[model samples]
Target: MKVLTANRLTNGEAVWLAGDHSWAVTLQAAEVALDEATEEKLARAGTAALLKNEVVDVALIDVELDSGALRPVRLRERIRAAGPTNRRDLGKQAELQIAVAA
Candidate 1:
């Protein structure tokens, strides 16, 4: 599968393209394109978001459903999704851990 991602303009938060043409903060909520055609359509929508100044650095990324969890295929994307690995106490990973603990 493929997914579209970018950084939100206002806060620079990593975001994914949602089904309704909106940006989602979490990958689990991202819209997945099962084929090249759908990926192209999503890329166009991402371009629109960029032109409207809603996001930047928009790109299509390969992903897979690993044990029911959607994960990015490349290391760079994984870092982007999880946040800074050098600082485990920061970003999405930290937030997820906190949520799990609660």
Candidate 2:
């Protein structure tokens, strides 16, 4: 499977293309493409977003659904999903952990 990802131009935050056709911070909210047609559609949307200057570093990421959870195949994408490693208390890492704990 695949999912579209990009950095929001305004804040350089890693975001995913959601099912509602909006940008979302969490990878879990990203719309998963299970086939070529969907991947192509996501690619087109990513290109459009890039041209519109709404985001940068747009990419289609390889992913898997592990026990119904999203998991990026690459280490780099994993890091990106978790946010900056320097501050564990910040970004998606903290956000996800907090939600789980709550």
Candidate 3:
């Protein structure tokens, strides 16, 4: 069982850790929205499971608590992490490929 880990910034942005062990922020547009319909579309498109166990914090949604201290709203998608596990194995994509040994 391979794992695909990524770090989402505090600004609602996502960065993927590539196979080369490098950080990249080149994800699709639909992956950043909090809309339910958008998430469904991503699931149909086979890109939903990429963000499993991902916690994203909001940088500018701080609010004053009862103690007169500011705290972040902390928007996150807990349910998205536990979606279908029947998708393709992203980690072994190259190894499962078909090579012509001519």
TM-score to true structure, per model: 0.93, 0.90, 0.20
lDDT for each residue of candidate 1 in 1-102, tens digit (9 for 90 to 100): 999999999999999999988898888889999988999999999999999999999999999999999999999999888889899898788888899999
Count: clashes, candidate 1: 0
Instruction: Report the poorest 10 consecutive residues by lDDT, candidate 2.
Output: 83-92
Cα RMSD for candidates in order: 1.1, 1.5, 16.8
Q: Judged by TM-score relative to the true structure, which candidate is superior, 1 or 2? A: 1
Candidate 2 residue-wise lDDT at 45: 93
In model 1, the Cα lDDT at residue 87 comes to 98
Off by over 4 Å in 3: 1-5, 27-102
Query: How are the candidates ranked when ordered by TM-score, highest leading?
Result: 1, 2, 3
In candidate 3, where is summed lDDT lowest over 10 consecutive residues? 57-66
Instruction: After the best TM-score superposition of candidate 3, give how far the Cα of residue 27 lies from its true spot, in angstroms.
Output: 4.3
Residue-by-residue lDDT tens digits, candidate 2, 3-27: 9999999999999999888899999
Error of 1 at 26 (Å): 1.1
Rank order (by lDDT, best first): 2, 1, 3
**Which pairs clash in model 2?**
none
